[model samples]
Target: MAVNLPLPIPENLTAVAGIELGHAEAGIRKADRKDLLVMKLAPTATVAGVFTKNRFCAAPVQLCKEHLAGLRPGAPIRALVVNTGNANAGTGESGLAKAKETCAALADLLGCAPTQILPFSTGVILEPLPVDRLVAGLPKAISNLKTDNWHNAALSIMTTDTQPKAASSKVTINGQTITLTGISKGAGMIKPNMATMLGFLATDAKVAQPVLDRLVKDVADRSFNCITIDGDTSTNDSFIVIATGTAAVEVNAIDTPEYKALFAAVQALAQALAQMIVRDGEGATKFITVTVEEGRNVEECRKIAYSIAHSPLVKTAFFASDPNLGRILAAIGYAGVDDLDVTQLNLYLDDVWVAKNGGRNPDYQEADGQRVMKQSEITIRVRLGRGDAVSTIWTCDLSHEYVTINADYRS
Candidate 1:
């Protein structure tokens, strides 16, 4: 087991006083372990969410996609239900019914329509959920809800994750402080289609739903959707933003520089949380950054970057502290992009120029690459010698434990 490292929660998150957190140990996967989460948003709040693009997505994702439309400019979501240890995917019609039932139950508690509640699930796939356990745990969980239990809420929704990932940020909007708190869970099977993982971000800002939706989608495209781990998108991916309108800032629209500042803050929060997922990746000790620049187009740049990031050989090499540059070169060559010209390629390992003009630099040394790879984090720069388009992708090393864990995931 990896040693427990201190996960410092981000700064400036105490401003959102209206939001509440609730979780219960449903015994769905293991006895005496929490596995259910409910987040309460204030009425009159605004909400926006993005879901997975997979055709076989979970029932909750589909439900959320439809319900988020209801949380318009003045409307808001009442509750969010997240369950771990059972994805509730591939269950066909029954799963859809259960998702609706959970939403309806929460709506009843909150005295709102069923369409106002959103449900999300993660964990094992294809198994019918033990709805009894969830129901039995609901009342107790609701009673246990607290305002500042951010850490516990992050922990309760984890599956195969060594540590809980949570991030917070405080931004000043019209001189009023707004707090953003988010949590995510993905140790394996992560390749964000929307969230490409399970993440929820809540804030006390008063942004309109349309603005929030557009900003959330743009941020997700550059952050969560850009990263890869195993390149297998899950059936239960979700990312949501809830604005409680309690910040007391009457921010009008997204056209001004202040709006740009708030948007930047939200994007930063999403990127921070997304990086946490990779840092605590299943069996990962090193975080790798892959940058592909000078591509003919944005798509080609990302294609090459993801190909290198998702390459098992590249990941294992990173794990072993071996800077196998040849594997990276080969990955880019076969990224399904055209224009093969290694002579124009430039490479760097952790910012140290290593490859130049399709050949190893004279100053490159095995010790240099090994030293760079030994750091907890690394960056690999690949200049494709095409246009100026560039993209950065984040991932983690692949270790034997990764194989061991997935090999016996169901056993």
Candidate 2:
């Protein structure tokens, strides 16, 4: 059961003007499943991406950075190949070779340079990518390419995700309507330093490559970077944004109205996708939002927020819907904010004041705390009487099913 997550409707997923997507049953790690996806981009399209900071990042991630660095102004990214169920990570030299081979295979079929193609993989770590099966399926994916295949593309990227995560929005900039649609897949090993899992967002709006690069980092900071699940970052996390340059409006200036509108739309879509990852977290039964405020700086607030969000004690209490709210305080105390003053802190579950001035509030009731905990969606707010900085993170409650899921993950 995936908390309150629901599959996205195919009809509502609009297609970007210069992007075509397709998927195939590659039989890479599983039988009768769509585990391969290929995306073809227009010659005018430009791409920007942010990858995981994990030291042991997948081979595809390293290759993606190298390939993106080789991107020049006129030579746009031609194709993107992705495979699920075998993260090309921890295989060392062999993994790098396989990732390059996958790119070369796709580039050969597309008649483009190997450096023009970006490769991505996700799933079990320390496993070799079955490049043979993946390469054999490229022709079928190419044959199936279509502009309206976003729904199937989303489904094809799944690893342990119970449902496909996707979102779409339209923004009018300078009288031109630009469509932004994206899909993300993540269920566990999530705690993204840059992005939780694999996310690809495409738009038809024209933007300069430099601006696009800056925009991706900004968008990720406010969206994908704000989410976490289980506090373990994956080796294959990637968030990529593509600008197809099909819209009539050109977003060259950050100060322009068009740029602001486009940025907001993209950030909103990314946030929606990030939240979906938490809602669909493996065996998750509750969605939690931890908000920390009045810190000396945004970084400190984020540390405190993550401390609470990542605490197994706090998450288990959320799972049981128990009023053992003190665990949240314990997390805050140990959050490494050396100067944090407990006497000036306040805690609330939704609107109910759970703690004040470093102790249980006199008016706080266990029933009220339990009431908020029982809800499928919950907000835990903490206010520190310091500065004005604040940070919020999305996560899910720890449950027995989470343990069971990971225990049998390889099976």
Candidate 3:
């Protein structure tokens, strides 16, 4: 079961002005299920994305990079198509050709060049994509496109997610209102090397391509990149940010106050969406926040935070509501901080001071630890006492159901 996660209210999911979304039941992997999504963009929109760093990336991921990299100032991305149930990864040349063919098919429907469309896929890897079914679903998806389909778009791209993840917020800058709405999906095979899931955020603000590109990477690093579930990155991890240029708030450079405001608003929404993915992680019962503070740099802080988050022993202990916190210390020790001084370290489980200065806090009790561990939401705070740097990562406890889910995933 998901931990403290709720379905997003459809009425609250405001739509961006320049993007229209539609979904279709393609039955790519299962019968009568929403498995395809098309997002048609206004001509004025500019798109930017960051994809998985896995060497064996999916064909669609490669195509997206090529399409975005090949963008001319006048010819921005026109549309995005996402299909669930089959990740076209590790299929070599033929898969690449099929992905290209899919793009061509969509471009023909939209009366645009094949390169103007960015393609995305997520699901079981190493299997040939059923391109004919996905292609056949395109017209139906495009036919139902609407500006207010963010909620259904969220559901259409889901693979292992227990529920759709979507969020919306509005931020005003210079008298112009910017609305940001986004959706993300992933339940397992997560640990974003670049990002182990799919995230699409669209805003009606006007932004230069260069600025949007920078924002996407920065937003992703602080959001999707700071999460882990099972520590396994996918071949099709992607996070895309779209700027429709419909609103009067124009940001052309990264140095402006407008850009700062936009980044904050987008970051907050992205964080919310990314956290939802962890909260709904496969069989997750607890949403865990691993925070490492007072580090020499952000890198070291993140390394230690990820170490704690990815520790199976610690995760299982969290699942069992067991305060076997020694596993946490062990994880921190092996986190590659060679010059770390354990004597100065302090650890807290929520409000309970479990460890003080590298030793068990005298006032700490087993009951106190268990109290926090048993909660659906828990925070693991580690004060490194090294410097001013801090980093936090969201994760979920490893449960037996997670194992069962994966063991029979393709069956």
Clashes of 2: 0
- The candidate, 2 or 3, that scores higher on lDDT is 3
Give per-residue CA lDDT, model 2, range 27-46, as digits (tens): 99999999999999999898
> Residue by residue across 108-197, what tens digits does model 1's lDDT show?
777888888889998888999888788677787788777787888888888888888887888886677778888887777888585347
> By summed lDDT, which 10 consecutive residues of candidate 1 come out lowest?
1-10
Off by over 4 Å in 1: 1-5, 9-15, 70-75
Q: Report the C-alpha lDDT of model 3 over 1-411, residue by residue, as the tens digit.
A: 678888888999998999999999988999899999999999999999999999999999999999999999677799999999999999999989999999999999999999999999999999999999999999999999999999999999898889999999999899878999999999998896665589999999999999999999999999999999999988999999999999999999999999999999999999999999999899899999999999999999999999999999999999999999989999999999999999999999999999999989999999999999999999999999989999999999999999999999999
TM-score (all chains, Cα) for each model: 0.95, 0.99, 0.99
Q: Which residues of candidate 2, in runs, are more than 4 Å off?
A: none
User: Which residue pairs clash within candidate 2?
Assistant: none
**Quick one: ranking by TM-score, best first?**
3, 2, 1
Ranking by lDDT: 3, 2, 1
Which residue pairs in model 3 clash with each other? none
- Model 1 per-residue lDDT at 96: 91
Indicate whether candidate 1 or candidate 3 has the larger lDDT.
3
